[model samples]
Target: MASGLFTFRGKSSARADIMLGLGVAAALILAWEAVARAGFIQPQFLPAPSRVLGALWSMTTTQGLLWHAFVSTMRVWVAFLLAAAMAIPIGIMMSSYRVVGASLEPTIDFIRYLPVPALIPLSIIWFGVGEETKIFLLWLGTFFQLVLLVADDMRRVPHEYVEIAFTLGAKPRQVLTDVALRAMGPTLVDNLRITLGWCWTYLVLAEIVAADSGLGFVIWSARRYVKTPEVMAGVVVIGLIGLVTDQLLRAWHRRMFKYL
Candidate 1:
């Protein structure tokens, strides 16, 4: 019987993991509802999940929540793509060439440490109080981090891959394109996923300083009126957005690198 039991291996289902995750989420929601309904916390301050959902629905129906969400999403993608465009190439160069790395690493590392939010005043002055300024702020928050991450990813490419390329008489540019980039594709996808999260985290900071519209603006406006439910609703929306995008990126990563 013990021998039979040892041979009774079974495949695990991802659905089981999904169900467990949902179960945990439901339990947390129930716990929160209980706390709110039991008077354990002030409703005005904490706001029940139901109240926050109602506020979210109200915003959706009357206050253009969907539009604000779309605008914020667009801003995030725009800044992320722009940062990726510049960072990927520079990062590749830094990894592939000693001279380029030496010339840029110190400055990039130094500037990266100087808090991005602190540059709000300089960004406002340089880009003006427009969409440009907001985008610049978002870009500033994400770009340097991405550059360093991408450079590190590139550096992680196996030395043997470069040696093999050289054995085949491959040029430097060809080695970069065919070897380094290709080998680092999975890591690059992962780094971008993480950096995208960083971009979302900075969204409120980027949008709050400027004019109106977006999730951040909604939260900021609600804060002035002491609308706890609305503030919670806005926070919930941002969390949901980030969660959805993170999942989508992970799915893409799995599809693209199924072997891994």
Candidate 2:
């Protein structure tokens, strides 16, 4: 691979697209700053970019911000990985077995339609205000979505490839592992972006309910004290962190499938 404009000889247009996207972002920021200074918007509600950045700076020197970020991220990591582990197998099973799919379809659909927050009272009542309760919130919200997505995706895997796998003396299990999953991989890779957002939502729910620390906890605490800037600061820090993580994941995705 080359650097800069030659990074991909055919991707000159991609570079121009990137430039255009950045130009639009810059324009928005400039407009926001101009509007804020002209008193067209209240800083208290929609703070200027400079004030938001300053709040982020202030949070950096405080121990709470880093702790909050780390705690929230760690919880999300654990919950998301658990959900993925449980979901992938169940999803595969749903696609593989007619009985299982028929049995689960209605139940899963009903659960998906139900609001996870509505179950919070039950979750807290059953699990108490503990980590289990928080994890349940995350698992409940994400598992059904992942199961449906992965199962439908698996069902759509090119039948010809699976048929060929069977013709080659491969077992059903072998075909599923080597053929079906391979076909569904690109979509699974795409789901990672959605998974990140879902994980963030789980973090918010966890912090709102039982957490004494974490980004959402910080937000809640700041709101109580009317420290709007600190809350905004936490939002900025979280956004920046999420952007960095998302970029890294996207880069990995590109690198892994670049040859495709």
Candidate 3:
């Protein structure tokens, strides 16, 4: 059983996997609690998980934590959907047509390499400190990266699929839609999942500059007053949200592509 649990390239039941992950997490939390109780680290620097949970409860009950979380979630989803709407088509075009790829790839490559925080100032200038700026910043962070991933997914569709479509007397557009798009469905979903995680990461950067609410704002406000537990609580909330989103996407992927 021990060897099976640690087997190389081996699969385990979902229950076993979940138990293993939970056990590790519980152990880490217990260790953290012990260290905090023993004064191995200052509470202000690294609070115990229990303290963080307490802070989370306090904030949720009295400090509008739920509202802030909702705002941040909305911002992330709006920007992510917008990015997906634009990037998927642009990426398909880029991958399907050499001219589109040549024209857009260089510019995308250049912009994506630029640090997102650096763009914050320009985003502010472009869209002011309103919700637009926040959404744009989040969109910017995810869009470039997602577009590349989308293009790569489209490109990775086997040539034989296209050939078979053509052999069946399919039109060019049908080949693109039925053959290429369908072939890349799983990978495209995977790319979106990956990029959605990227979108969440940019939320702090998006909200830190000029926002009054959201998890990032809560975290930053707590940091200003040296409220370590609140800051850690905010971070924990974001991690939890991201983890839930990832798992949902994974389940969707598994359901949609049962053969895989």
Candidate 4:
């Protein structure tokens, strides 16, 4: 009975994924047909998905939309990678030392709970209005979260892995390289993916104050002129870009670690 239930979950998960894909495809087709037929929504507002695609086509021809998309992608990529780079090292160090981890927990926890959006005012104040400010703002929102998450990942690794390594005469550095990092694999991927999504969200916030170009800034500019379709188009572009990035990351993970 236990075996049957466990096997059921694998089959269930596959079915669930298929259902989700089909459901999304169906809904999009319905929306596309409905909006195109209604014709009540002005082209400037709520352009049908087909119309949006047309706009996207023209955008590609002229390179305007692609340029903005690259700007947003650059911001998201640089900030997220920086956060991951800094967070992983710091997290490993903190987790390696019990006293350091204990002493730092309160501060890390406090910053993690603080409203990330609220930091924008101070980010601008400290960094001034420029790309650095935007990158720093995006970094702030994702950094602490990754820190706590990675530290937790390290802490949750089985003690037996380290014990066995030590009994086999492995040094501290060797155990960390072969054991601790390997143990953090799944958790690190999960956390990093989640953080990337948050960084995209934080990009919008970053643009509110300092960006001259990006999908977020484009959305705001379109909305200010009441070009809702363009606003929606910018939103669609961001969603697609994020989806592409996430799929690439998933593929990389699969290629690098078949066990996952």
Best by TM-score: 3
Mind giving the per-residue lDDT tens digits that candidate 1 earns over 174-257? Answer: 998899898999999999999999898788887888859899999999999999999999999999999999999999999999
> TM-score for model 1?
0.93
- C-alpha lDDT (0 to 100) for residue 70 of candidate 3: 97
C-alpha positional error of residue 68 in candidate 3 after TM-score superposition, expressed in Å: 0.5
Candidate 2, residues 46-103: lDDT per residue as tens digits? 7778887787777767655787788888887778788888888888889889998999
lDDT pick, better of 2 and 4? 4
Cα lDDT listed for each candidate = 0.90, 0.81, 0.93, 0.84
TM-score of each: 0.93, 0.89, 0.97, 0.88
Ranking by lDDT: 3, 1, 4, 2
TM-score winner, 1 or 3: 3
Candidate 4 weakest ten by summed lDDT: 1-10
Report how far residue 118 has shifted in candidate 2, in Å. 1.0
Alpha carbon deviation, residue 136, candidate 2 (Å) = 1.4
RMSD score of candidate 2 (Å): 4.0
lDDT: which is higher, 1 or 4?
Answer: 1
Clashing residue pairs in candidate 3, if any? none
Instruction: List CA RMSD, all candidates.
Output: 3.5, 4.0, 1.2, 3.7
